[model samples]
Target: MERLLRIENVTQKFGGLTALNNVNMHVDKGEIVGIIGPNGSGKTTMFNIITGIYRPTEGQVLYQDEPITGMEPYLISRKGLARTFQNIRLFSRMTAFDNVVIGMHARTKTNMCDIVLHLPRKRREEKECEERAMELLKLVDLYDVRYELASSLSYGHQRRLEIARALATGAEILLLDEPAAGMNEQETDELLQIIRRIKELKKTVILIDHDMKFVMNICERLYVLNYGVLIADGTPEEISKNQDVIDAYLGEDDE
Candidate 1:
């Protein structure tokens, strides 16, 4: 299996607080991996570091074996790394389709001169982006609501639309933060299907979720974190039985 992303001895600190302490984890191509822990176990902190929002205080992040730590967030996105936030950060006034089209900006090729001159290149690019955006919307099962304002969609639809937008960035490795957080059972089931479809596209996914059933059902591998430390990493079965994970986060309700 080819490793697509690696976090080697990554330690992140905010003044006196250590949000992540010498954590090590990796994701291989075409895998759905779960990062699970209690509320502040550095799950989002890990996503931030990987997406270049915050540079780790120690160690490095490797993508396809190339160091990408401290790279600009836009540059990382251009390199095919994209993510969705725990809090939905959509443009409330914009249509769902437009939101997805905007995500393709980093990957689109059109200069100001071409756009200003109404050049064929610009027209062609715009058409292509629109087509791709529609396809992404369809992927998330939001094609019917493509013209709807993001703010008007249901919470589950909004979350799925965010996934489509992330996919529009041409990302091969997607970091999803708590995608199942605000979802009901039906919506969570829909998300599971969507993520499986993403893997079918050969994309790698790393997700954080408090829903054990969802995580165990969807993820092939699991990494358990607690208080900024990596306590365990293995298959779902292994993690379900990890004593430290149980003591720290899972408790008696892991099943």
Candidate 2:
């Protein structure tokens, strides 16, 4: 498999506290990896650092086998790395279509001269962006809600909208934070289908989620973290029966 991302001995600190300690991970092309841990295990912090929300205090982050550490979030996004927040951070006042179109803004090339002159290339570019936004919305089955305000949609729909927006940014690697949060069984099942579709569409996915069943049901590999370091890396079945993992979560060696 082709290498897509790699994290080598990354350490992150916040004032007197250490959030991540000597972490190492990698994601191969076209793979779905699940990250799981107890709260305060640095799961979100790792995502933030990788996506350029925060620079690591030490170590390196490589994307497509090239150094990408400390780069700006927008730059990373433009490089085909996009992320969804643990909390939905949509433009609440904007329509779903508009929200998605905004994600493509960094990639849309239109000069002031072209805008003032109403040049065909500029018009076509904007039109193509809009069409692509719509296509992404359609992919998540949110086309009917295209004109609705994102805040007015149900939780599941909003989550799907976020994914659509990420897709609109032309992400080759998607970092999803708790994709199954606040979802019912049916909604979770739908999300599973959507995730599979995204993989089929050839985007690599790395997600942090608490739902064990959801993670085991879809992810190709699972990484377990506790405190600030990785404790296990294996298939679901291997993780399921691991004594250390059981001890970490249950305070006992036997599961």
Candidate 3:
């Protein structure tokens, strides 16, 4: 399998505190990988470094073998990498369709002048953007509520809409942060199906979630972090039995 992303000796620090220390991991093309760790274990820090929200204090991030470390977040996004925050960050005032259309703006080619003049190119691109946004909405199973205000949707639908918006960015790799954070069992099951569909669409995904069942069920491989260090990397079955992982995150269950 081709390596789509590589984090080489990545480290992050804030003042005198080290958030990530010599972390190394890789994600293959078309694979759904999971990053699991307890809170403050540097999972989000790792995502920030990968997505260019924060430059690593040391080390590098590579996408398709090209170094992307220190690149601006928007540039990284335009390079086909996009992410959703742990907390919902939708355009609450906008309609679901409009929120997705905003994401399409990054790939849009129509210039300011074209839009100012209401040129034919602008009209054509606008039409295409709406079409694409609607297509993504359907892909995430939110087409029926496409015209509803994003703030009005249920928490589960809001999460799905956020994924649709991320898809609108034309991302080949999606970094989903706690996508199942507040979802109930039914919503989580629906999310699982959506993730499978995303995989079928040939998109690589890296997710951080506390839902062990959800993560373990969907991710082909898992990387475990503890106290800013990678403690284990393996399949779900292997991780489930790994002593270090069990000690750090999954406490001993009553026998």
Candidate 4:
């Protein structure tokens, strides 16, 4: 298994509080990893550090064996990493298709002049973007609502739309932040199918969800964080039986 991402002794600080304390993590090609913790346990903070939303105060992050720690968010995105926020952040007035189109804008080769003049190059790029976006939407089972206003969609579809938009960015690794929030059991079940398709698309995912079953079902490995430190890392079965993990977040009766 080739390592797609590696974090070595990462530490991040906000004032006197430590958000990540000498944390180390890694993911391999085509692997689905889960990070679980209580609130303020720094799960999102670790994602921020990996995606360049926050720079690590110590240690290093290597993606594809190259240092990506402290790099700009755009730079990280360009290197085949993208993330969805805890809260949906779509363009409210824009159609779902257009919102996804804008995400592809970062990776499109058409320059300002090409777009302004609507040159042949621009048309070619636009066609490709639309095709890819539609494909991603189909993968997430949201193609029928492509032209619907993002704000008009239900909370579930909106979250699926965000996943489509992130996929549009051509990211090989997706860091999903609480993707199943506010979802019912049925919606979460559908979400699991979408996630399965994402895996078939050959994208590695780091899932952060409140749903314990969702995490354990799809993730090959799990990492438990408590108070900005990693308390456990193991398979779902191992994590379930681990005393430290049970004490930290999953109570003894959780399994």
Candidate with best TM-score: 1
- Model 3 root-mean-square deviation: 2.3
Query: How close to the true structure is residue 205 of candidate 1, measured as C-alpha lDDT?
Result: 94
TM-score of each candidate?
0.96, 0.95, 0.95, 0.95
| Candidate that beats the other on lDDT, 1 or 4, i.e. the better one | 1
Q: How accurate is candidate 4 locally (lDDT)?
A: 0.89
lDDT of 3 by residue, 2-84 (tens): 89999999989999989899999999999999999887889999999999989999999999999999999999999999999
What TM-score would candidate 2 get against the native? 0.95
* Per-candidate local distance difference test: 0.92, 0.90, 0.92, 0.89
Better of 2 and 3 by lDDT: 3
Report how far residue 15 has shifted in candidate 4, in Å.
1.1
- List residue ranges in candidate 3 displaced over 4 A: 116-118, 250-255
List RMSD in Å for every model shown.
Answer: 2.0, 2.4, 2.3, 2.2
Worst 10 residues of 3 by lDDT: 246-255
Please provide, for model 2 over 1-255, each residue's C-alpha lDDT reduced to its tens digit, 9 standing for 90 to 100: 899999999999999889888999999999999998877888999999999999999999999888999999899889889999999999999999999998888778777987888788888898899889988888898999999999899999999999998888889999999989989999999999999999999999999986678999999998888888889989999988988777777752322
Taking the tens digit of each residue's C-alpha lDDT, what string does model 1 give over 130-217?
A: 9999899989999999999999999999999999999999999999999998788999999999999999999999999877788999
